[model samples]
Target: MAERYEYLPHHLLRRRVRDVASGAEGELMAVVNENVSDTVVEHWVELAYIRGSSGREFSTSVDNIEPAVAI
Candidate 1:
């Protein structure tokens, strides 16, 4: 079977992001999207400060987010 998204709602995860312009380096709260096609699953998170320009939210594959064991 294919991999599953283990992180649940309220779960936290650390995403490996770039260190360039507007790069994010910190823990992010996970918000799983239940409305997805059967073939795919995903979640939305806000790492970069949500504001003008960075107003758009980010969508990441469930596979990319790992459980935040500490902090």
Candidate 2:
């Protein structure tokens, strides 16, 4: 199953929805195990991206670990 996602920073203005769009509301999402091989493996990660704050952007990525978690 494909999931929809959106992000709202703490600095952004907050709003309330009064209607249902047949979807979800959150910055994180988890799609069902579709179009993926059962034998294939996957990992949860926080990819590096531009973070805009104080009128500046920085480059960063997940630190290298000796052993990745299995669970």
Candidate 3:
């Protein structure tokens, strides 16, 4: 049988990533797995950044984020 969900690779954690659709950039904080049904699972990623003195966070599908290019 095929797998229901694929977890993000460990090496990707704490790495910089960019949201493909939004162009937002931040550090990859975590991977979350949600079971939608007996046979269905969804993979998500938490991206975070500090703006001034506060920290901000957002979650999106793992597929929507990619390693950020350093300039």
Worst 10 residues of 1 by lDDT: 44-53
- Clashes (backbone N, CA, C under 3 Å), per candidate, total 0, 0, 0
lDDT, candidate 1, equals 0.39
Put down candidate 3 lDDT per residue, 1-71, tens digits, no spaces. 34444454545678888877677787877775534354445443333331211257776667787788999
Q: Indicate whether candidate 1 or candidate 2 has the larger lDDT.
A: 1
Candidate 3 wrong stretches, greater than 4 Å: 1-9, 35-54
Best by lDDT: 3
Tell me model 3's lDDT, rounded to 2 decimals: 0.60
Model 3 clash pairs are none
lDDT of each: 0.39, 0.24, 0.60
For each candidate, give its TM-score against the true structure. Answer: 0.29, 0.20, 0.58
Q: How displaced is residue 36 in candidate 3, in Å?
A: 5.8
- Candidate 3 RMSD computed on C-alpha atoms after optimal superposition onto the true structure: 6.0
- TM-score top scorer: 3
Q: In model 2, which residue pairs have backbone atoms overlapping below 3 Å?
A: none
